[model samples]
Structures are given as structure tokens and as C-alpha cells.
Target: MDKSQLLERVIELVVDITGEDEVGEELDIDLFEEEILDSMAAIELLLAIEDAFGVSIAPTELEREEMNTINKIVARIAERL
Candidate 1:
């Protein structure tokens, strides 16, 4: 998938996992800082991202800070893709 498509799917997964539509409200907002996502939800997100994009995300390969926002997550996934 292209970056925009990837971004949309990622946003959908994040919204579903977090049960907060607010995630879509700000593409650059930090989910952690906004309390829209927690550690458990983050794990769920990682798994969902793997399933949705067929891309593996090894925690050791990157810092968690790289996943602090939607755009950043998409960039990471795009790199893996």
C-alpha cells in the first residue's frame, strides 16, 4: 500500500484499539501524552499493524519514541514495507 493508504489503515487500527476517535483529530498529537493510548493498547496496536500491513515491527529495531504519533508510525511501517 502507498503511504496515504497505509496511514488510513493505521489510523483505523489505532482508533479501534484505543476506542478513541480523538486519535484522528490530530495526526501529530502524541497518543501517550493525550492518554488516548496506554502500554497495553500500544502492544495491541503493534500486533494490529503487523497484521494489517504484513510488516514486522521489532521493538529492538527502533525506539518507542518513533511511534509516538500517527505520522511517525506510518513512516516506520513504510520503511519496513
Candidate 2:
């Protein structure tokens, strides 16, 4: 799939995991500090993204910066692809 499609899927999977409808929300909003994502939820997100994109996220890639926001995560995944 394309980058945009991958991003959309990521958003959908995040919403499912976080139980939020973020369609009209800000992409750069911090889900962690916002309390929208907890530690367990974050792990699930990482797993889901890896599974959906068929790309592995290395241990060195587990920085909080890369996962700070939805936009950033999507960009990271796109870079991997």
C-alpha cells in the first residue's frame, strides 16, 4: 500500500486501540502526555503497526520521539517502507 493508505490504516488501528475517534483531530497531538495512550496501549500500537505494514521496528527505533504523535509514527513507518 501507499504511504497515505498506510497512514490511514495506522490512524484507524490507533483509534481502535485507544477507543477514540480522531478523524478530525490534530495529527501532531501527543497521545501519550494527553493520556490517550498508556504503556500497554503503546505496545499494542507498535505491534499493530508492524503487523499491518509488515516491517519490523528495531530496538533502537523505540524512542519516544518517533512515537510522540500520530504524524511522526506514520512518517517513521513510511521511512521504513
Give me the displacement of residue 20 in model 1, in angstroms. Answer: 0.4
- Candidate 1 collision pairs: none
lDDT for 73 in candidate 2 is 83
- Where in model 2 is the C-alpha error above 4 Å? none
lDDT of 2 by residue, 1-81 (tens): 887787788889898898889632789888888888887887888788778888788645678877878888888888888
Q: What's the C-alpha lDDT at position 5 in model 2?
A: 86
TM-score (C-alpha, index-matched) for candidate 2: 0.86
TM-score of 1: 0.90
- TM-score to native of every candidate shown: 0.90, 0.86
Worst 10 residues of 2 by lDDT: 58-67
Worst window of 10 by summed lDDT in candidate 1: 56-65
